[model samples]
Target: MEQNTAAVIRLESVHKTYHLGEVQVHALRGVTLQIRSGEFVAIMGASGSGKSTLMNILGCLDRPTKGHYWLDDADISHMSKNELARIRNRKLGFVFQQFNLLSRTSALENVELPTIYAGIPPAERHKRAREALERVGLGDRAEHHPSQLSGGQQQRVAIARALVNHPQIVLADEPTGNLDSRTSVEIMDILQRLNEEEGLTVVIVTHEPDIARYAMRAIEFRDGKIRRDQEIEERQIAREVLPTLPSLEDADAEEAEEESKVAPGESPAKAPA
Candidate 1:
């Protein structure tokens, strides 16, 4: 993807502090960064490193305690809760580790949620949702509930939901965390295609080095500050990597072997014993 020089997200000396009882917890300390339009960025850090806090601020889910944030040309540092909600629905899409789909809802209905919040017309919302599902390669599975889909398919539906709103930026927090290695790459492949083919700006928070390599740029956070920011010289192309990974059939066979090790009535979670 050709990187656009225009900055879509800019944070100047951003700081976030939490007051828990009488103690203060500093989540972000004067962190400043810019993510240009059409760029794929990975934010990496260990637990308590504040990467999640930064993502929340960028997604307009939370306001910074100090410093300024400019999304495109508007400064949203002081936007009210309702205003922030409006901006989130209009400009941003989010994917999380949990997939976060409604258990009883079909994938198409799940993807239509953001549009409903945006007050899109019902007819248009259905059309957009179907198109988004097709974009994520889940058009055939649109009527399936989350329970009927595999872990990878579920995440793809979540990705479809994110795209249904036609958001300028997609913010994903540990999007592949719950999946196996091959499935993780599959999710990254979808994100890569979205960025390269659709020209969508992508930002993901991940701790896995292999997953981080899929991003064009990597930003490492530590102790509430950015410790490193650099382009990935040997960026992994997900489409290329996918062919080398274990095939879905192979993964399924392995999974079946593991399931056989557990007694028929026993939960997989208790198989180790």
Candidate 2:
């Protein structure tokens, strides 16, 4: 298949097979898709539906067993491991379900690690890392370690790490899996801002319909093949939806008030006299 000159990602007849002893597992079968630059895409599938495998191939972390993959007009299916690593560092950013931060390291340090691998100068790395942290609304938390921050803050730090490199595409796998409902929407808001304001291509894998609704396009995979691919007619704006959702802090405060109604060790039967 001929690659599109404008597409950031173009996969043609892509197939991935994993051999386990005598059995061969076919993960993706003939997946041909093109994602234009600055598009927000959500990949949906159940477990073992090949979405993760497709993501790995798209991110240049792994090569397809059979087929052609072009990233920005460059055919990378035949690239060596070293070449792929360089491409990944130069053009790709990844976010995983797990925060993937070092517990003892400060948030700023965690976000700065990728720049070191990218060969950024020490002074410039600090500048970019701090800018990314501030972009994610974590400037005040830069000195705190992972353990000192909440789950959402940790994920924000992870996002800052992803953005510090300023890659063309950001591939996020289940980015909101560990966050609460409100926090998940908040994370989506951040992703939406990055896509809209910075023109970054954003591709995220998520199983939740509510989460997928936030994207402009949705692609569903089933039985190792793309089952459906279509643009959303009326996409829900995360910023608009956020205001309608209940606030997590308010909910926590209400819960605390309810708990305060009763003393910590006081029984219902023993009233203060």
Candidate 3:
């Protein structure tokens, strides 16, 4: 492991296996993956395909049975639970299908949780959380609770919380799974913006091909190994920014109506025109 390198995640011959009764279940069999700083990747797999296991390993939440794993020059495969906890708190951010906002907490406070864990001053934490919310176009909803926000808005707040730490990489698991099609597209647009405008490295695990299409590269996992890895074609050339949920709604409604005119079972979310 070299110092000052740009690669944030590197795994070599990683293997993860679990023992169930007298049987052994290999979740990740000899996996190797590397993510450079600023890369946007999507991991695609069916249920029980080891994608989640790999994500856990990358996120430092679980250890591999064998092989080397490095995060920014630190070999973490042998780190103690406390060391892994510290590293996860500092270097990683997470967004889930469920927004996972705290109950009885305002959006601003939800976004402040990570910094609070680091023992940052309250004033500083609030300022950074506010900026993070603004980055995701949720500045006006800071005072609202998660229950008060729409699905997309809640996800935005969750995203803001993830970025509040200025983490080097964001680990997203089924980030859009709970949203409607239009709303899912909206969330993907926000993530793409964060990657392009802020140079945030993002790695998402998803089962939907449409959602995975938003990522720059897609890795397919099958039978505990990578089946395919390649850059995505038809990369979105330009993404439109909407300042509010109403604007997105209006745009989506108009687009859906237009698509309705083009025979049944067709979707206009694929392209605006």
- The per-model lDDT (C-alpha) reads 0.88, 0.86, 0.84
Report the C-alpha lDDT of model 3 over 138-163, residue by residue, as the tens digit: 99989987656666677888999999
Which of candidates 1 and 3 reaches a greater TM-score?
A: 1
Error of 1 at 133 (Å): 0.3
The number of residue pairs in model 3 that clash at the backbone is 0
Please give the distance, in angstroms, between residue 37's alpha carbon in candidate 2 and its true position after superposition. 0.3
Q: Candidate 3, 7: how far from true, in Å?
A: 2.3
Model 1, range 4-117, lDDT digits (tens) per residue? 248899899999999999999999999999899899999999999999999999999999999999998689998999999999998999998888888779999999999999
> Which residues of candidate 1, in runs, are more than 4 Å off?
1-5, 248-273
All-Cα superposition RMSD per candidate? 4.2, 6.9, 6.4
Tens-place lDDT per residue, model 2, 27-112, is 99999999989999999999999999999999999999999999998999999999998888879888888778876889999999
TM-score of 1: 0.91
Which candidate, 1 or 2, has the higher lDDT?
Answer: 1
